[model samples]
Target: MRIDASVITPYPTFAYSVLDRYIDGDIIIDKSSALIGTSSGIYAVMGDETNDDFAPMLMHEFKRREMLNQRFTLFSSSERWDRRINELLGAKLQRMPRYSFTFNEHRFMQSQRAGIPDGFRLNRTNKESLEVNREFDAAYIRKYWGSVERFADKGFGFFVTEHDVFAGECVSIFSSEQYAEIDIVTNPLFRGKGVAQCVAEAFILECLERQITPRWDCGLHNTASIRLAQKLHFAAPETYSLYVRK
Candidate 1:
């Protein structure tokens, strides 16, 4: 489900959050001010450009305070349900498009077939593990790869270090809903190695030992991430759609 660009003027913050989950969308525009977030950059209407940003600008006008009570759903499989729910916006639920890749939890420790080059080890992102996350921000993350803080308040990871440079990291985000969100990121120089798959295996084992079900998400166009997930064990592909007031 995608919200048209013109409707974000009044509530840009909410709109920015929406884009992190949207595919083929960027630059939410409006007037009043510019508010950019991690997933996509936000732009506000100004000077002669006012007419160009009408899409997001108008979205704000149509949003109702009652919408605060409305809920947007992310289905396990996207199936154009969001369009069907548009008529019920103020009265019932809001549907959005989202595709989830489900993977089985690894219970037993596999062999060391996956290697992390040499002289590096997996570490957690918690207070005790390491702090590579502080040095890395969202902007740098958007290029070629993206990663989550993984339960930020209580993050855990294996920091692959090369002579102490903090090369890359891995994590498994845990939510109360019992969903397994696998997250991994490597230093740009270490792209083609089996680093991610290695960390993912360990992460899945961690989730299984805790009894959590793993889940995966990627843009419909991000073939690399999608393939990696499938290779690492995302059972199959399931699609969901999203919709918002135009």
Candidate 2:
């Protein structure tokens, strides 16, 4: 069943990426309930929690199709939905804390800036640059956007390179009309340096120009990511539960 995209409220940016057709994904609707699944194995459940039989039926279908695996994480839209998922998954579910941040323009502009190292150059992701970095390579983009061509058309990223070596990259892992979720990776050799910030700043600059809200999400244990986000002036950390298969 197909449901109106407007009905699936309070979803993560990735789910919106799916719902808005910015990326390829699976959508299943049953009466007032809906499930949106992305290629990266993240799923969002929204609407009527009283539909007790919906989730189990979908689980059965997933198992039959061999798609019920340990790699998937589930996001529930509300507390009632959370309880429903817990009841359905039982001991197989492990809840983890995820932190979400809002971008603050004034703080970002006020934050200390990091200049690209003398030999380093920041470039937007293109056919040539995508082939240079494994972290933001064709495979990674395909995993999120379904195809390199689609990503090239709708998505944008920035990567830093020193001579010919890839230093770090920041890309929109998922996006919709109004939001772009950030995913960053700094090479081990460039970890202590500001390559991440520089590349990420370029990505943010483009987002601001495009009128898209850049979003940052990280797990509680990823202290480094949290610190970097704070340094980039992404404020108001709100914690949410992410249910993983155990």
TM-score of each: 0.52, 0.89
Question: Top model by TM-score, which number?
Answer: 2
Colliding pairs, model 2: none
Write model 1 residue lDDT over 102-218, tens digit each, in one string. Answer: 564342334333655666666555543433453434432332123333334322345566666666666542222244455667677766766667666666666666675556766
Residue-level lDDT tens digits of model 2 in 1-246: 565555644468888888789988888788878888887777888878788658776576445334644357788677787778777775767888788888998888787778676789988898777776768888988887998998888899988888768899888998888788889999998888889889888888888899888899999889999998988899898877788766
In terms of lDDT, model 2 sits at: 0.81
TM-score of 1: 0.52
Count of backbone collisions in candidate 1: 27
The worst-scoring run of ten residues by lDDT in candidate 1 lies at: 40-49
Q: What total of clashing residue pairs does each candidate reach?
A: 27, 0
The clash number for model 2 is 0
Off by over 4 Å in 2: 1-10, 61-71, 110-112
